[model samples]
Target: MAVAIAVTRERREGETRCAVTPETVKKLIALGATVSVEAGTGLGSSIPDDDYAAAGATVRPDLATVLAGADVLLKVRGPTAAEISALKPGAVVAAMLDAYREKAGVEALKAAGATAFAMEFVPRITRAQVMDVLSSQANLAGYRAVIEAAYAYGKGFPMMMTAAGTVAPAKVFVMGVGVAGLQAIATARRLGAVVTATDVRPATKEQVESLGAKFLAVEDEEFRNAQTAGGYAKPMSAEYQAKQAVLTGEHIRKQDIVITTALIPGRAAPVLVSAEQAASMKPGSVIVDLAVEAGGNVEGSKANEVVTTAGGVQIVGWTNLPGRIAADASALYARNLVAFLGLMIKDGALAVDLDEEILKAAVVTHGGAVVHEGVKG
Candidate 1:
């Protein structure tokens, strides 16, 4: 018999992405695995049930029906403890397990004898790039951030030379130069904005310039060493932060739009835009906080809410920007999950090998214990 791969509807609020799409359903079936999807799972992504059935998926009416004794469970978010406890012994679960903050969920998976892998924990190495959930999703979030900011702005992105007068292009400043930051620069530039981006890591300077955006920052010694061995930005010293703040704050006053994407895993997002700095911007300017869900990088930013400063600068704290573009986000994310499952499936059966570096980094629970390095005892 073929291995059963069951994809679940996301129960987490504001999650519109699904683990599998019709395109991926066909791929999984071609691999000799039986694919089942929960009813209404793809509706948020604008994929109807008829589409999944046409693509060779069994559409179960309810969660229990779809998940019953499945060899594999795929999800956009981690399953609750109740859902994990219902799985068969040693079942394979892949999702954004968020193991660092959801330590209790890791313990539940261990108790249920389920091998759970957090897609977000996948290594940044070349071989696992296709399976990188963060990159796949952050790319969409970055693009959407610009669109959102443009909508909230008082004027257009591109400068216009009209018969009567000239309308100058909006000034966009993006903080943080990860996958999201790079895409944001590209998008903003394409929209004809004068884009300027800054990051503590010196390497992002070329990346920003490559996208036709100017890089702004103090290239001091601390800025050069601000990147970790894992390729993530290291926490800056207070003295360094103070120096960068003065430079950025003054620049913020002149920017028509600002987007901040800095986030530290398992920690509160560092405040990149202070309250006073936000209030100092031009009255009609706008700011988008992509890290709003992680306690926000901009002061006065609220999750899923838009806050306007007393000076009339709008602060957009819309969480899950990827979900705002659900269809494409789901497609790309589903492809990412398919790429990851390809490594574990062998001869039409479940054959997970934890020794693989990518799997070793992502597996949060196995053999009745919390196993990932990110999880402390």
Candidate 2:
């Protein structure tokens, strides 16, 4: 029997990126999979229905009819309640499920008897680089974070010397030196801002300094080794966090712009900035929290909303930063999906190699069961 893959039309709120593109549709068809797309699914990303049709896909206006016989489902986010109920038992789903963080959504998929793979859970390793959607998406989020902050800042970024007088460069302090933070630092510096960044992980100092930005050091024994084996920032001890918070609070008071990007996988973002810390900022300071979706690093942050602190500082907490650049974001995401797709299917056939490391780490639900240890737990 020929396998059929369907692309979901509905996207999560503020999600402009689609899971797959017509180009990828043609590739899947060449691999012997028939492709069905919901009408207008790719509209936000600037891809029209004619594009999918030209690539040999069937475009159905009704989402239910398109998904009725789908053996595989590709999506930017997890299936919603109505969508899950529409799925056939034993359907295979591949998407950025955000599974560990989305407990209710995972339960729905299980009830619907869908075999699921979460792209976010793909192990961070050289072999899995092509499937690393988090990196691809975070790179965009980081880039957009700087642009958004600069827009809301109400001042120039680069230092300038005019006929009137010399203008000092804006100072940008970035929290969390992961992919998003690093990119924020780079982007801010390109705009001529003096960037200073910090992270719990000691290794990030070099990365911060390598980008021609200063590294804010909260030197202490605990911070010297505050990293997991997977290169993720580890939560610090209470005593260490207290000392670092005091030092960071002092630093926050003097910056023109602050971008916080710290996030721990499967955990809520640590509260890095207290309300007192926010009040300490100058009246016109700006803070952009990239972790607003998973709680927030900044005390006053609210997802997709901006608030003005008592001191008149702007707190930007828009969660889906990458969604603003849907065209490029979707292109990179489709490449990531294709890479993961190659791992599960080869030569136009489904090959479920359960023991394979990549498959083992990413397959959240299979055979009517939650197979991943983390998800199952």
Candidate 3:
């Protein structure tokens, strides 16, 4: 008999992305797993019930039933407390568990006796790239951040010269040129914005300049090499950080729109922009913090809220920006989940080898305990 896999839609407020798509559902069916999905769950992503049916997935009306029978529960976000209670003991759940801050969700998974794998915790290894939810979702988030800033800014993005007047191009400053920051630079440049970006990593300078954006380099002997081999930003020394503060502070005051995307995995977002820097921006300038969910990179940033600073600059800290483009985000996220599950299912049965490198790295809670080294006590 084939293992039963349930791909339920997330019920968390403001979460619109779905973990499984009809295409992935069809693949799971081919691998000898019975696929079940909640009704209307894929609607936000423009995936209809008929699509799932056509892909060999049964659409259940109630979430409780869908979860109760699931041998494996695939989701975008971790299951809510109530939903967790209905899971079959030892059922495997793969999703963005938000293990760092959402303690309640973590506790719920332990109590419900389900093994949880956090897609966000996937190690930055070549073998895990296809299964990386953070990279897949952050790519979309970075692209959307530029679009959001463009929409919010009143002036034109590209330079405009006409018989009447010549309007200078908008200046955009992006902090933390990770996946999101790089995309923002590419998008802003395509939109004709004069882009400048800063990162602690010396390696990112080439990437930023390749996109035609000026890489804001700070003259500091302290930050000769400031990147982890895993492609993550390493915390800078206090001396280097102080120097960067003064330098970037000057650059920021002149930017028309700034987007900050610096975040440390499993930690609170580093405060890149002090309140003083935020207050110095010219009136009507905009700042979008992609790390708003983890305490923000800018001062006074509230998750999911747009607030005007004392200097009249607007700080937008809306979390889950990728969900705003739900259809495509879901499609990509579903593909990521499919790639991960592909490793877990072989020969028409569930084969969870704890020894496997990818599985070992991503599995946060197994056998009803927080087992991942990063998340474990």
Candidate 4:
């Protein structure tokens, strides 16, 4: 029998992206999966029901009808409590479940007896790259951060040599040269800004320099070995952080725009920009904090709101930057879901192998219990 897969509209506020696009729906159908989509699921992404219907998915107006008896459920965000209760026992769900923070949602999935996989938990291995939602989304977030900063800044990014006079180019400083920071640097540079970036991970120096951006760091022994084997930034010592802060504080004061994208998995975002740092920035300067939702990398950043400090530094902390560019974000995110779903379907039937490394890492609940080590009590 063909595996039954259902896609529903995301219920999260300000989430405009959908889990499945018509293009992915066609691919799922070709893989022998019976795809059902709730009516208007793709509306926010500008994908109408007609497109999904044309792509071989049954578009039902009622979400319950779409999910009823479904063998697998796909979502952009974690399902709500009522959505979890609607799923059949033994059914599979895959989404950006945020298992690390949404403890109640994980418990609800366990109680509902649904086998759930958190896309954010997918390992950062070569084989799992196609299924890595975090990278795909963060890549866009980085690009969007630069764009947001440019919009918020009163001056032009590129220097202008007008007949009146010469205008200097914007100076962009990116903190935490991870995927997002790298992209922000590239985007700002492409817009003709003078970009400089720093990260705890010493390995990123080459990447930053390669993008024609100046690499700034304290460059101590601790910085030499500040990355995990998985290439994640390891938390630096207090002394190292203090030294780095001094350098960043000086750098921040000179920058016209700053974009901070540092995030520690399962932990609050590290504070790279303090109130003093913001106070030192020039008036009309802008700061975009991609880590705002995770407690903010900039001191005055508020999630989903742009605030101007008393000194006139605008802090852009709008959450879900990927959703701002919904069409492309939805396309990439849906493809990620399709690739991940491929792992669990065999011979046109839902066949989850919990022993698989990707599944083992991502599966937060299975067999009526929270099974992921990080989430289990």
Question: Which RMSD values do the candidates have, in order?
Answer: 1.1, 1.3, 1.2, 0.8
Candidate 4 is scored at a TM of 0.99
Local accuracy of candidate 1 as per-residue lDDT tens digits, 1-377: 89899988898899998999999999998877999899999999999999999999999998888889799999988997767866999999999887877878888899998999999999899989999999999999999999999999989999899999999999999999999999999999999999999999888999999999999998899999999887899999999999999999999989999999998887889999999999889998999999998889998999999998788999999888999999999999889999899888888887899998888989988989888766855
Which run of 10 residues does model 4 get worst, by summed lDDT? 342-351
* lDDT by candidate, in order shown: 0.92, 0.88, 0.88, 0.92
Query: On residues 145-236, what C-alpha lDDT tens digit does candidate 2 reach at each position?
Result: 99998998878999999999988889999999999999999999999999999999999999999999999867788888888888898888
lDDT tens per residue, model 4, 102-155 = 999999999989999999999999999999999999999999999899889999
TM-score for each prediction? 0.98, 0.97, 0.97, 0.99
Which 10 consecutive positions of candidate 2 have the poorest summed lDDT?
343-352
Best by TM-score: 4
lDDT of model 3 at position 292: 92
Clashes of each: 0, 0, 0, 0
TM-score for model 3? 0.97
Of 3 and 4, the candidate ahead on TM-score is 4
Better of 2 and 4 by TM-score: 4
- List residue ranges in candidate 2 displaced over 4 A: none
